[model samples]
Target: MRIGCRQKMKSIIKSFNQQGFAILHGVLASACIEAVKRECEKLVDELATKLLALGRISDTYDDEPFEMRLIRLYENHPSETPTIFRRELHLRGFFELFAHPRLLTIAQAILGPEIRLYPNYSVRPKLPENRRTEVLWHQDAGYTSAEADILRMVNVWLPLVPVNVENGCMEFVPGSHRGGVVPHEKDEYYLRIHDDHIQPVVAQAVTIEINPGDVVIFSNLLFHRGLPNRSDHVRWSVDFRYQDATQPTLRNTQGHLLCSKKHPSNVVRDAVHWAELEFQ
Candidate 1:
């Protein structure tokens, strides 16, 4: 059953507050979508060119038989990695997508009035012919050690292209939040530390197909992952996590400073880890 606008917004807010996830369908209008798509294409082309010039395009460690759109230029060329955002290319314009007013407003509403922006922001592009491994299901918390209760972190996933179930869109287990942090399977991303079920209930599955510019909001504790991209076109998206001012943070999380108009201010404390870190 379709719902009225006011009711829909209320439900969305409520759902996110309770379950730590919410999908705002068609959040980005067509024009903004086009703008982001074009910018992403241009950035991808630029990054790819640089990598090729540097002779760094071998095969990604996680590289399987899948078609790869973006090859983690920074991951391969860590020496050239930018210092601005989390493992990002130091591309300011591209990182701006995280702080887009509409995206932040929704995050602010859920994370509380004051939030601190993590310096870590990134873009994931699943290119045509890039079909290797499935983005194993996991929670954002699996990558961090922040306080679970006081933390008000929200990850905003903005798709640069239309996302559908067939082409490896994200799938969420509705009400999975009630289960708390389930143990995850340790693979390439991060190993499951706690003893939780590997397979979550499929009956509650809800695949979200978002158009360009649409944003999906979810917490770090939610169980989610990107499906395999089977489409001929590339699937591109960016992510940003925000924490409430009262929560703890990783000082060197991604090894970047946490200050940008595009970043949030709601944070708790900041810490650092010397061990190698992957995406958060």
Candidate 2:
């Protein structure tokens, strides 16, 4: 690796080790960002067409900006708006961002050379005035089985649009990962940390405001939540995880191998190959 690139990677790893999270600014190329935006636009357009055909919406809202289009379509029918897109993630744009070499290198810094993209990848659209989009405070590990505690993993969150407190930016409790798994309860839409544990650290919470090309890498054990979208537009972001290849995912679905020094043949070759894999 080049000297400058190596230095940046080292800094990211150091920050992650100390704070349980790190932010890399402007890491993604403009072309990659535009591609993902285009894909999001296509998805919204398809949904609008379907809603119109069903007489749920009178217009497709085709001319609206990407941030406002989704919000307008689900104005009357909030339940119809998708909070997460799990299937069809093998699309070209998603695959490009998923397997971007720079991102994989950062993952490699923390997870060694062998890395596997975890199966729980998602693209979230946090819409305005939508209760479904308000995520509660909890650790990512809380949602997984107990066996997952042993899995060495890191999560990467990249926003498609600018995210701030009003648009439901994520908030994190610094160094909270040092505390193992806390008790969580099933809430209406998400699992939340118990009040006793969350209250003490709530004051330390930091709202993560980020731009389109910035990426936030945080520990799975970190306490975090997505605030409500009070702004008029949608907050679009993609989140995915990378785990050490040698560890078990604790789930039936084995995620795709992203990189491996010992067995390079296992790594995903290109976007076309990614499109062939089934969503797990």
Candidate 3:
């Protein structure tokens, strides 16, 4: 069984190299899927209960000021609160999803066995009309200028919920990875989304959809975005970016650098060691 899994993973890695991305259908076993579902559900229930107790569920952020909104919730929230918004939420038991045996094997094939976490693991849950935060078409490197040019980053986007085109599924321009880095403006990103900055080298744009337990691995340089979720339901997915350990990360405002790992061996390293970029 283990050898079969390894062979399948090798094929997926080969496909990823040929193309910029590959979707592994039903990569997670049924038991693992159920475990993830239960863990996420429990987190929601706990959040609801805590909100009810402190009247924070629906109104906590409603009255807060802009600076307050920008405050890092991962550090501010009680340690018990499940970290949900990307960088800080190191979903404890959920490590299996990112470091799954088969998934890591495939990653090893692409990134070498010495794979290092990108220090920016995040879960983006786009609630219906949640402030127009859909990322525009741009290379992920444009967002992480601190890294060297030779760096090859891979983002593994695993959706806990089945994602489709209408519900903010990821859309990519095929063969965009071949273009490498393209100049991007601050206005074209999360702040003010636009397509004029992204030169379309690939004539056809592909909408990627996946079921639960499926994973989409793509080059970070590929042009992609979380399309606007027109549906009433929320789109939930976690993006785990990985790169070689020797990359340089940018420093933050507090004189502290991010992703500065000395060991870079463990999957659960602190955030100060991962590379991060300013969101303009």
Q: For each candidate, what TM-score against the reference?
A: 0.69, 0.96, 0.72
Model 1: how far is 135 from its true place, Å? 1.4
TM-score of 1: 0.69
Tell me the deviation in Å of residue 247 in model 3. 3.4
Model 2 misplacement above 4 A: none
Ranking by lDDT: 2, 3, 1
lDDT string, candidate 2, 1-280, tens digits: 8998789888999889888999999999989989888888888888998999999999998999989898789889877788988775777777789998888888888988889999899889998878888999998899988755677888999899999999999999999988788999999989999999999989999999999999999999999999999998889999999999988888888889989888899888888888788777
User: Which candidate number maximizes TM-score?
Assistant: 2
Extract clashing residue pairs from model 3: 86-122, 86-123, 259-272, 259-273, 259-274, 260-273
The best-first sequence of candidates by TM-score reads: 2, 3, 1
Off by over 4 Å in 1: 1-8, 51-86, 89-92, 128-133, 146-150, 189-200, 254-280
User: Higher-lDDT candidate among 1 and 3?
Assistant: 3
* Best of the candidates, lDDT: 2
Local accuracy by lDDT, each model? 0.58, 0.89, 0.60
Could you give candidate 1's per-residue lDDT for residues 2-82 as a string of tens digits?
Answer: 367557767878988676678777776666555555555555566667767777775332332112345354454444432
Report the alpha-carbon TM-score of model 3 versus the true structure: 0.72
- Residue 41 of model 1: what lDDT? 53
Q: Candidate 2's C-alpha lDDT?
A: 0.89
